[model samples]
Target: MKASTKNVIKSIAVLSVIALVCVAILSLANVFLKKEVTLDKATVKFLNEKFATTAPTTTGTDSDTAYNEDYFVMLTDGELSNASGYTYKSFKSNSSNYVSAIYYAQKGANEGVYYIESVSVGYQNPISVVVSFVIDNGDFSIQNIAVKEQREDFGDRKTQVLNPETFFYYVSLVKSDEDMNITDADIIAATGATTKKSVAGLNRAVTRAIDTMNKIYTKSDEIKAEINKRGGQNG
Candidate 1:
């Protein structure tokens, strides 16, 4: 009986050791594989909490690009104190387009930002993004595009073209006005999408964001009034 009890204790100890090793392996896997907020997932208040800060920007970011991750987080994050006292407003799309929702806010006195949400409709698996931007009165300046919910592959194509070196540079040459708008072909051109079949859904999705922002900035009576009240600066 004494021998049997000793054997049982030894077995239990061995089992406990194995169990701890398994747990350690799992913990390491989880730490390495954790995903970030709102990437490839629809924009939601819950998923966005993790994306509150911008990842250190990529290598190609232009010094003039306005993509302020903090401004976007501020626009979407209701918890943050609005030191600029920006009143939140929603602009709906009456036209037949994928422009889902639009949110605009002014930071302090002159700088303002737009959170234009759009979704890719025809993709096998749809993707979305908030084309966050600042309209420079001097020229077209895209601050940052708050990425979707776009898959890694297609979404990468969309931005690779629109990045500072490619799309912004290309637009600077063709544009005749300081208008904050883009043509459907702009994104298609940006991604270098080819004929027959391609990743062209992002074309309209991104355009919708820019178009919506322009409509509000240029046409909205209220926005004009507010701009005049603040001395008519687009920062």
Candidate 2:
């Protein structure tokens, strides 16, 4: 072959290689810039349906008021204090305890993931629990909870029978209106009833209190299970 023809062929080959490299780079760039599309349509529809049914409707105009209606109403509406003057407060702070449900939609797609997050309260000695949920593809539900801190009135108790740990449990039950109200009921029932008052009446009272708290624990577990089920449906 002629030298000039060989040089021309080599140059053409180099240009072809450069063009191929440019095409490959552009293809990768397009992939990176492309929007993520959710592949699950049924799951997205289920989430939307579930949210429409379960989500609270708020009519308030103010941002804070709307937020309170949407998030804080459930936590505050229940009678946290009973006739015993016991009050229950969540260990999670206002900013932290806030529950938010978010929905993502693609520009041209009908389905996307939903995110939900909220705080749940639970108890342990010298430590209170706050749970945060992060549900992928649906709602953010409580994935796990951690011990935050002890109750506020951990050490201050007026009654000697009210040991700090047990007392906290007792007060929590009363505030939450759990079955622990039976503590006073059992005490009242046992009083003046000569059948069982003969031996260690104080021990019976303590036992009643402990039993009531145990009932609260059982109730709490039931509540947690329900929450988890709801979360699974979406998250």
Candidate 3:
């Protein structure tokens, strides 16, 4: 073969090898970076079904009514105190006000966890107070808890208190127990004082806040149910 022809063929081979290497690297990077996101729709549906199966039915027996009243009384007494407790001290100092809403999530057969998220419309910030419990034979007991502020941006300033793993860890603490119960002290201990600038706005904000908390609590039930259903099928 001519020397010029040989040189051209060698160059072509080198270029082809480089291209193959680049493609391989990209493929590996994509595989490594791919992450599993929210649960699948079908799995969520299955989980909801399982959760319902395992959940205790609410009855109107006198015992049941009394138990519920006891739980509510405990929560109400707690509310009478500063709704957010010491956690709201910072906001109070700055005259940065807040409004809170209580949210409940089922933890097990007779247990439910509560979360109090306070929103400061003045500063556009939200603080979270978590309380968990279980009700056994009509008694409420504390399980776990955490109080913290969420991330936010105030024009030139930005802040984040906990990462996703840590935040989820706090959430899991409340949701993992099967026999935890609710109590008045637990409710009082979980929150601090709340002040809303506008009464109507405060009412609306509190309602929405409670609803949001409830949504998150229900999601745990959905996940557990789905996992159980999938496990049963495999068995």
Candidate 4:
């Protein structure tokens, strides 16, 4: 081959290698990205499915079918406090992880309830749960709970956190005026959760959900103001 032809061939080979490397990097990035994003996707799907009946309807649809709009609002720390009226006392100022998102059940049996989604580490992986908190006359309490995901296999012990009727045993552990500082020891003492590690995970999650509810209650006035500012009236 001529010198010019050889140079061109070498350049093409280098370009091909660079392209392959770029593709590999992008593919790896996508996998890691999905690992983080999958939790969010699952959270959204869980919220929508749980609150599907009460979702708002899109007027232009051919049929009068109501659409489940993305109801979970992931508020920043400032927005959660300043904008959403979340109180500082309800949650531990030093603690970092808790209540990742809040969902409003707009129109159904759960009409005015707020669902707080929280996560805690289990024996193997993170445990995510959503609890419905009802606000009535400035008092807030956990009305129901749904476990979105739990990585551990707890055998029959999962019933302690999964069933609402039985789960109230855990809710009863929380005090309205105080922060929920439940530990593994507390979880083991309060209920028949087989594995202390699993029980502790669920307890921490439940406590966090209650904390979010209490914060909203403490700042009920601010929350009302926020609602009114957005053209909504506090019920």
Best by lDDT: 4
What are the per-residue Cα lDDT tens digits for candidate 3 across 1-235? 9999999999999999999999999999989985322223322222223123223321112333423332211122132223333222222323333423333332223335443434433225444333343334544443433343333433444222223333344234334442324222332233221222222222223333333333334344443343344332221
Candidate 2 wrongly placed segments (more than 4 Å): 39-235
- Please provide, for model 1 over 135-224, each residue's C-alpha lDDT reduced to its tens digit, 9 standing for 90 to 100: 666334445555455542454334444333454443442233235354546545654533212234455555666665555444333443
- The CA lDDT at 181 in model 4 is 66
- The TM-score that candidate 4 achieves is 0.56
**Model 1 quality (TM-score):** 0.39
Predicted structure 3: clash tally: 19
Clashing pairs in 1: 40-149, 66-143, 67-143, 67-144
What ranking of all candidate models by lDDT puts the best one first? 4, 1, 3, 2
Q: Give a tens-digit lDDT track for model 4, residues 1-235.
A: 8999999999999999999999999999988875432224455456546433334321222111213332333333454568654533345423334665665644444445677777777666777778777788777766656777776665544535435445556656654323666666665566656677677777777777776676575665555445445433212
Q: Rate the local accuracy (lDDT) of all candidates.
A: 0.44, 0.31, 0.35, 0.58
Span of ten consecutive residues with least summed lDDT in model 3 = 71-80
Decreasing TM-score order of the candidates: 4, 1, 3, 2
TM-score of 3: 0.23
Q: Per-residue lDDT for 1-235 in model 2, tens only?
A: 9999999999999999999999999999988996332223432333323233123321213223333222211111122222112222322234323222222221111122222222222122222222222324432222222222334224442222222333333333333443334454443333322222211222322223233223233233333343344332322
